[model samples]
Target: MNSFWAVFKRELKSYFTTPLAYVFLVIFLFFSGYLTFKEGFYEARQADLKPFFVNLPLLFVFMVPSTAMRLWAEERKVGSVELLFTLPITIVQAVLAKFFAAWLFLGIALALTFPLVVTVCYLGNPDIGLIVTGYLGAFLMAGGFLAIGCFFSALSKNQVIAFVLSVVACAVLVFAGMPTTLNYVSTFLPPGMVAAVEGMSFQVHFDSMQRGILQFQDLAYFVLLIAGWVAACAIVLDERKAS
Candidate 1:
């Protein structure tokens, strides 16, 4: 626990000490708002953040990876991974601490968009329950993406390679949940297989939560997905240590 906190504090502080955190926040906030108002038709739509929520998964495809690309990549790049291993903490603890730090930073960035909630409430009566659920889904989805990013970051010594690989990997998951992707798959695959693929989509689970329907299965999918990737990260670290 002590070692976890130590790494958490160091990694979280590292985000702010450099320009990365600020740049990411600014870019995210700007694009989120732009997409919501311009593409989302915020003025024309009813008192709902549906458009914002709709765009979030796509935004996360790029943004979360950018934030996570440095987790272990930078450590290896500068040879600080050796120092990290020298600590009393186990590899799993370090992995969780770093993952949580990045995840929490994403939470902070998401929370900063609260003014959107405020604006929607001020405009008219909105389903507060639905809005809250949407944010919850977004946060969970971000964690899932971050976990994938962390896995790839641990695998690569170059940050750019980590970012690119994370983006590609996350993009597949994101697109898999889309109706278009599923439709394309259905043309080639049988109905049963198509349904299975659709069920595996991050967007499918996220869309359910976005609608204020918090199914246990949807929640479990994100939890298990994150756990799986984090475990993979630990394995990669172990292999590197062995090598």
Candidate 2:
């Protein structure tokens, strides 16, 4: 537990010490706001933040990977992964610490968009429950994306390769459940297969939470997704250490 906090603090501090955190915050805030208004936030004449929540999955597909690409790839690239493994911390502990640190960084980034919430509140009355659930869903979705990125980052020494692989994987998860994608697949595929693909997607569950419906299965999906990838990341790093 002590080792976990030590590494977690070290990892979290590294973000602010570098330009990556600042640049990510700026770009993320700019693009998130731009995409929101561009989608007719005002023109829709609605007080809700639907435009913002609707665009998050697509934005996270690219942004979260960029944040995660350096997690293990940079360590491997500089041969510091060996040094990292030499620490007293176990592989699982190290993995969880780093994952939670990055997850918190993302939470901070997500929290910085509070002005959007304030704006919505100022505009008119909105469903507080829906807004709260939407943020919760977005945060969970970001964790899913980050976990995949962490696995790919551990799998590659090259950051670009990790980033590209993460982006592709995240995109598949997000796009697989889209209405158009499902419709197209169902044209030839059996209904069970199509349903299975849709169930495996990030969109179907996220959409439910975005609409303020937080089912146990939706929560379970994210918990399982995050745990599965983080476990994979630990396994990869453990093997590398063994070798």
- In order, candidate lDDTs are 0.92, 0.94
Q: Using lDDT as the measure, which candidate wins?
A: 2
Distance from true position, residue 91, model 2, in Å? 0.4
Q: For residues 154-200, what per-residue lDDT tens digits would candidate 2 score against the true structure?
A: 99888999999999999999999999999999999999999999999
The positional error of residue 9 in candidate 1, measured at the CA in angstroms, is 0.7
Among these predictions, the greatest TM-score belongs to: 2
Model 2 scores a TM of 0.98
Summed backbone clashes in each candidate are 0, 0
> Once superposed on the true structure, which residue ranges of model 2 sit more than 4 Å away at CA?
241-243
Clash-forming residue pairs, model 1: none
Find the number of clashing residue pairs for candidate 2: 0
Q: Any idea what lDDT model 2 has?
A: 0.94
Worst 10 residues of 2 by lDDT: 234-243
Tens digit of lDDT per residue, candidate 1, span 124-209?
88899999999999999999999999999989888999999999999998898798999899999999998888888899999999
For model 2, state the Cα shift of residue 38 in Å: 1.0
Q: Output the TM-score of candidate 1.
A: 0.97
Error of 2 at 184 (Å): 1.3
